[model samples]
Target chain A: MPKQMSRHSTVLKSPRRQAGKPRPHSGEPTHGPLTAEELQLAVRNHSMPLEALRKDTTPPGLHYVLTHFDIPFIDTDHWHLQIGGAVQRSLELSFRALLRAPSITIPVTLECAGNGRSLLRPRPLSQPWVLEAVGTAVWTGVPLAYLLTQAGVEDDAVEVLFSGVDTGVQGGVRQQFARSLPIEEALRPDVVLAYRMNGAELPPQHGYPLRLVVPGWYGMASVKWLSSIKVLTRPYDGFQQAVAYRYQEDADDAGTPVTWMKVRSLMVPPGVPDFFSRSRILPPGPVLLTGRAWSGQGAVQRVDVGIDGKWAPAHLEHPPAPFAWCAWSMPWVADPGEHEVSCRATDASGAVQPLEPVWNYQGMGNNVVQRIKVTVGQ
Target chain B: MPKQMSRHSTVLKSPRRQAGKPRPHSGEPTHGPLTAEELQLAVRNHSMPLEALRKDTTPPGLHYVLTHFDIPFIDTDHWHLQIGGAVQRSLELSFRALLRAPSITIPVTLECAGNGRSLLRPRPLSQPWVLEAVGTAVWTGVPLAYLLTQAGVEDDAVEVLFSGVDTGVQGGVRQQFARSLPIEEALRPDVVLAYRMNGAELPPQHGYPLRLVVPGWYGMASVKWLSSIKVLTRPYDGFQQAVAYRYQEDADDAGTPVTWMKVRSLMVPPGVPDFFSRSRILPPGPVLLTGRAWSGQGAVQRVDVGIDGKWAPAHLEHPPAPFAWCAWSMPWVADPGEHEVSCRATDASGAVQPLEPVWNYQGMGNNVVQRIKVTVGQ
Candidate 1:
């Protein structure tokens, strides 16, 4: 997620509030500038509900959606992906051509780097996000590496830039949503220019016609509504690349750019009451604890549950797909009283989640441990 | 934490089980090899209770304790720290003399590298630790850097090894418990040869006479029962250094050694019921979500709460100290229903807690997101 820009006062006025203007995209209620009330409603309605997250596969309608502005209006009949800049051949490939290309399908979890930004103290004052900025889906598309090869990337190319059709004023500058990755990362076999999500043609909210799927990276790197691919000899200094998605230590430091999704795990809510509520009560008995754990760096090796404060081993179910999260559970004998429960996961790369997050200006990768409280009664 | 070795058959018989044998450490019932019954009692009595974690400062008695072997009996009156190996001057400084040296006090959280080991799959078959292997204390000690400088470290010195008096057979090898750190890390300002913990002389279970506190690194790197410091021109290949504290990717790769504490967070149970129990039932009302967030890399910038997958910004409290965790809370309006709640934290360095932990052979640094379940009723 890019750092939100200064709000343009003129654009804050919703099109609906201006007059009897029809919504920008027919059939898509969430496609135009939203009134304050509509914005809140949109956030509530568009978020991937916890109920939907309990299943192994995320249904398309339940997919988490995050966009900087309105979803771009794209006509599939006229859409084309332009490949230029440090490439020997500049080519414009229509949607049909992309569909005809050899395609591969892989499951990947795309998380917004700014997923927890709204929770930060002295908050960023923009994009008040909660954790619903993440989702996993099976994406089917041609490898971007293959497309780059077809365009014949020049020898001096150092970075690959992806630009989307969505444009707005951010950080006091008008620009398209653009980001760049090192050539090495951009050329990974799993990097794709996707047109299908979860076996269906891309939904309008998910960048219909085309989008970049830079697996393992934060969603910002996977530019939605991707329109152009540019091979660059120098690192791209576009707004998103140089300023917005960067993790700055302070005003003085040249920040590190957000990249791969950190290792994380989330449990499917066991049938229970609001965990943070004071009125939570329960009857002591045996209970099963379960959740899903995954990592962008490698496979999950183990997951342990900390019941109260005692740690116990958990049983891990094999992942459905290579990059999918592993399901884990542990049975606990509950005693009547208040209890705090939490779990930790270790990954193949030896990286474990931290008890706390490393703070950055952008609030990019907050993967801190999660805890919940519950009450029990006879 | 080093891997456990084959147990000596002769030592398996607990003195208590042998009948009428006096306890090894008078007044401390937890000393020596424990009988099955004693093991259960010790686990019940000695583990840090979760309620104690709710405060800003952890009381010494409430601090968590973990050890690989019996606590060594060290006479503070006769104890001395031996500094030798690749140093120009070899010196043995008595406890009093060491205390006379310049001392600084700093708060540091020490977490056992194997703190969550038992939680891993294929259970480690060793110390089955559940999460109570971590605590924070204010340590006062002369800087190890000062002593190393006085000892005149050799130009070629590459590593500094710390040896502890507590020793038993581990990994089938009989040797003193020892670990080494790179010269650069050893020379850090926070590395200390400590004689005090929380303003008092170190406790018996906490390496009483002397210990090394390597803040920021896992507790394993901070050798307890400190006896000697050895500077080495070559990398130290002690059992703990070469074979145990390392995180192996697979049987084929030379695993990376565990180092700094990863980012993580945990909430103090907010007066609730046993979360995992099936019989949990509650009356809906407002609930307060609260917890402490900290990081070894930097300060925590944010902590967000996820209520049934819907996210909300949390209000954060000022940290009591720079190294201490920042307190945070979110007011939640509970609706009658089953719900799961969780939280994530971001640090000043931009590192976020992972939803899951990266897996490793050593099961070190498992920092995964945590969740709990509860039921609300009318």
Candidate 2:
């Protein structure tokens, strides 16, 4: 019999462990490293563990979890791309043709459409993403602008449409999902129709053959399993346009509709109330307080790190590459005491993270200040 | 040691026997049906088996193959959604709240970005799809527009963003994926942020808790594992925008650089040439000419079926559900001579399938008329 299989990487270790009693903080005047049980307890409660305290950047393996149905595999040899609509001529190309075009790679950040949903007062009806819905990638492919130019997009062209190859049956309903974009963004020089990620060909798990990579926008803009591109005079109201990426204003306990939300950011590490107690021991002195920052509008201009409500100058790492998270660090002089750490960021477009809480029905674009507590002791 | 597991369904029959070769026309033409040996050969070569002559709608199990990657599973309790960006407030929600929202259901078709790719000459680098990348389903979810209205979109808001909780590495690049829509489309009534597919909650294979159900477009925009949404003043310029979705003009080979492709449709099934030559004993009597039709623009207004290059009208199912392939059927009136059949479609937007070929870098937007053949008896 042909084999049936489930494939997951062997390199990574599962973070989930057997359940135990939740750890309660003891207000004792002592300094020592936390026990393994204490670390597991903290994580179970959605709090950062001690190892998470060691680095500002959350390791990819330990990042939060979010998944839908099973991942699908797509063969690339026979893949094709079709471009039609408000253009002088329509075209269809092969995967090899797409790769031969002028290639550009951009480092971009993709945040989940519902990041930080776990933090909501009344949990939303979705995966409980414990703040791990973000990542950086170098996408390489031909620019959409280059293609549209070749097609001779008409002056009246308004929107660009995108589609992918994945299919599934939800209940009994069959779906041919798709989304569209404005011609303006479709013609942007940096907008890429990527076939490669990092330095390698796209993995089947990702969109192989071709996928749309629109920077500075949510990941939805980057369609996977891409097949067709249509230039439209007006707009097409597909389910995604009319339904998916939206939010509600009123804090209705029932949940709001999906629409766009406000700009927001998150502190990478030293999570809110990071420290468990004054008795917890910390690493050696002169520690590096590193974290990640990003903005929906443009590049992050600056990030501020504060300890115990006092602002400290932060060492901002110019984005390692464009369209990526900006790494920032602060050198802290450790002393045995209770410490509350926080970070905030400002974007080049003059947008800054909010210090107070903001509420939306869908829990979108939430860039509230990130806070973590730490106890420095020998 | 951890026990190894297999995901194969016990309820289903063995796939091995199902994967067989099509039969050759012979005898009274109706007996044991196509042997297993013949069926396998037909599928491998992207050819139709003769057994298709007996039925109207393709059996569910025999549906064409198209996929982006492996199926994924995500823990629901820990999943959450985050919404923020260009709004009055940022919010975070858990999976629970999303399910509690007022939900609506609608039928839509979701096709792979690469359906009919095998029709492209000179082979592309991806899967060789034979026009089965599409499916229809009744999706239930809250209108994203409703959510956006609740978000109290700011005056400058131009684009709405969507993010997913799903994650994977492509070409060594780690990305947290998301997509977006224009404000106009975002407010459309037809769009839905779906959580339940058909009558039941979405299966894990199909975005479990929620996914964007953008009708009339392609599949990628319906980002699964939704986590966040954002509103922006200007359009996004992420890698997916500039490089992946775009296609090249006049480049037919797989090596060409193309960003986006044109809008096109194919006549699946009845009109597909060489419809089914794999069976040895073909079904006798009136042959049912049946197929599916769809377009990237909107609803398919009409589908025409042709036998032996002679045009004949086919009846399209009523209420032609949006984003879903419309099923059509017609009597073949089998004669004693060899005959060829074909089918074509026109969408509500006045876009019709082309008889001639169009060229593009990625070979997307095929929409060429599909042809099938049948040899009648002595």
Candidate 3:
């Protein structure tokens, strides 16, 4: 027998801990401090390393991934995407059949709705993400609109619900991961049912055989591990759709649903990084600073690079596609001192990253400006 | 502008924390608790979920990854692996040339030296991993001995240093990631310079174009993003070699070098899991309990299933390869009650997992038995 296991220093001291009592999941926020449960979630679900911001389309493995439940393994041969509900004709398409359909490839950036949650003053007690919960990839698939038109949606259908094979208990409800999109949004030509990511078969972590690629929306809207689609005559209110991924001010508020991503930008930490602190240290010289920025509303109209607290407009390049992130750069002759480097993006619709993090019940849509600490040596 | 920023509950409360101080990294034990810096590393480098144990070969994305610095991107067309130092013939092999060399495919189980670091009474102030830092994969590559023999090693050569392109600062010293092996271990037939994993090009996070795969050794022995190899007449004392990854009793002790993984076993957590606690729930019935057991010293000899601390012998199967993990199973008839399910492994070398975690300065090799909490519902 292992000598009585006992060592959770933080959990023992935390006033919020219930100690052995299994609590049901809820939308309540932790008043202060991160918990052991949140730490477990943070380590299980990871964020993209900001260093990867150097690439255009994030290499598949480096792309950020989030699964509400465990990744469900799919045998391509045995998989069939069933499409039914209010449609005039139900359809079941195999992996090969979907690949043979009209294929279109495009670069799309996906950001998790809870990206900067850790940056919030009262950290959410879920995945305590600190930026980096975003990535861009080239996806190849059939236009979701094409499939919907083929099925001939009935006139009364108001929304389309997507159900993923991955299942788990959340808020005491055991159900498949499911979410819905209004009829108009589901009919967008660029919305895709993707089978491939960055020219490779979708990796299991990113939802193997098939998944929905909702361009311009936060990652939660782009469900993974696709199993079925149902055209609903009434609005869908599943656990994921109604109980989470919302912009709530308090527990009593039926917060507005989180949809398109807010404007955001991230800089590659400059110079050599410390193994633990990740603080940058480099000899003084002319250094090129670069990063990626984007928004779900539209193209990024401008990006500003800030040194310390002063801001300067940076050179921005057009993206490969309307929904993809754009590259931005600025040259700086760094002085010998400690400094903070940050970047902020403003989309065509004028949405910009908040200079400081905003607190919310579930900690969603926290597109706060990124700040990296660095030291320039002689 | 958003607002003034503030929050770090644990960092602020811990008496050991030095606010705003840029301290040099060291092997000093963090005698009491995990730190904010360790939490940062924990989330960046993830572990495989316990549920993934159900599979034979872990899916690539689910494989554990630990990068001390950044993942360097390699261009396959231009990359050449340089081989030099105490050798009669120096060689530089291109990616294409190496691919055409004699190939061998083998399944290897790799576990991190610090897999159970967080379990220590006083946690090591680095990536605070639990018991999930392990995975088995089928790797295809050219035999390392075949390449070493072709290059012709000199009689006086004592060790071989492997250099990876990833560069970072550790203990305030900046250098590329490097490690070495004794001449005898370097000439093993199964040691390989791998190019493919699970029949596909190694993903970027796992070291894209090329990497060294030393089967049966800890993952640190298999350098990722490998670029150069140098045969040495004397021991190499790089930071990674001399300072990190040592099994030290205290800072002053010239600790034994950490090498092969210790014996360990983990069960695939059965039934539905609570999203936060991960406590299991299942209907009462006859259930088959299964998991994987592996050791670098040799094959796993025995696996014992422990129900509420009572031990029972389990059925074991031969592994796919000598270096791969072996499967073990036991049948359990559950009643309507709560229980703690655990498993313990003993390797061919007669080394068995410790019942309780042993504390160390660097928190290396703490392979204590694994336990899971479950509830059998009516």
Question: Which candidate number would show the highest lDDT if scored against the true structure?
Answer: 3
Worst 10 residues of 2 chain A by lDDT: A1-10
lDDT of each: 0.65, 0.53, 0.82
Stretches of candidate 1 off by over 4 Å are: A1-47, A275-283, B1-378
Query: Per-residue alpha-carbon lDDT of model 3 for A294-313, expressed as tens digits?
Result: 98876799999999999999
Clashing pairs in 3: A2-B355, A2-B356
Model 2 Cα displacement at A107 (Å)? 1.4
Alpha-carbon runs more than 4 Å astray in model 2: A1-70, A168-174, A250-281, A320-322, B1-378
Cα-based lDDT at residue A182, candidate 1? 88
Please state what fraction of the native interface contacts candidate 3 reproduces.
0.59
DockQ per model, Cα = 0.01, 0.01, 0.43
Candidate 3 yields a Cα-based lDDT of 0.82
Query: Clashes per prediction?
Result: 56, 223, 2
Q: TM-score per model for chain B alone?
A: 0.82, 0.73, 0.92
List the candidates' TM-scores in order: 0.45, 0.42, 0.92
C-alpha DockQ for predicted model 1: 0.01
Per-residue lDDT for A337 in model 1?
79
- CA RMSD per model (angstroms): 27.2, 28.8, 9.5
What lDDT is reached at residue B227 by model 1?
89
